[model samples]
Target: MLPLSLLNTAKGHPILVELKTGAHCHPKSPTLCEYIDQRSTVDRVTYNGHLHSCDNWMNINLHEVICTSAGGDKFWRLAEVYIRGSTIKYLRLPDQIIDIVREDREFRERRETLSGNGTGRGGRGGGSGGRGGYNNNRGGRGGGGAPRGRGGFSKQQN
Candidate 1:
């Protein structure tokens, strides 16, 4: 396993894991890569989650991997995998990323449709259902509000 710190490196080339078992290399950190080459490819690749900045081009699985923060989480995730940094082919997604992407796409489509006429979901200019009434200032839903108990009954004090 790669160290936690290495998994999130924001400077050098990304650590590459050989598609075939037992081959790994860090193009930037040659020493590490050399060591990895001696190891069996079947070994699991481990890293601290740091990788070079997305500003630079990186090839992973023969695709360009664009790294970015996930929900501002401390760990970084593949934002977009491009064939040539412009044309996106596959998305390197972590678990649960699908929902976020789907939600974003849905929101954008709803906004566009709403702006076109007077129909759509929450977004700017779509009536109360639009972004009009929703408070931008409001943050995420966060944790659930005060928990509710059975039927309208409140917990009795001892």
Candidate 2:
């Protein structure tokens, strides 16, 4: 599973995002943190932390953040922090989130298997030109075994 996919599945969970702002160079600085939720979507992040909040709320850009910290470490607070996606070095998620994502993936796989469409193979079954199946009269195989090329290459008429 991809990192983003795992994050999606970890919605509503607490996450520690480490930014590439070069803050890690300082071993005593606090990073940014967020309580993952539905609003945790990228581009715009809604969170609560030490930063002052306007109207008891804060919205941050995902591309402005430099670094973030998670877990019991007080190096950082939950205040709203904005970090550029490119500046993000990595994200720390709870172990349970991994399990949750795994279960969800397995469930989807099972569902697709039960429906006979989980093989990832394109086209339909009965050989009727499924989704992206080729239907043109190429004369390859399937369909009507019409001759080979477009009109056999006649002897050039001499």
TM-score winner: 2
Predicted model with the maximum lDDT: 2
lDDT score for residue 75 of model 1: 26
Clash counts per candidate, in order, are: 18, 17
TM agreement with the true structure for every prediction: 0.31, 0.45
Per-residue lDDT of 148 in model 1: 24
Residues 37-132 of candidate 2: C-alpha lDDT, one tens digit per residue:
222333322222222211112122322223323333223332245434554565666888889889998998888667653244432232222232
For candidate 1, lDDT tens digit of each residue in 34-109? 5555544424333332233443343323223322221222222333222222222232224333454556667878
Model 1, global lDDT? 0.33
Where model 2 places Cα greater than 4 Å from the true spot, the runs are: 21-78, 118-158
Q: At residue 130, give the lDDT of candidate 2.
A: 26
Q: Whole-model lDDT, candidate 2?
A: 0.41
Please list the C-alpha lDDT of all candidates, in the order they appear.
0.33, 0.41
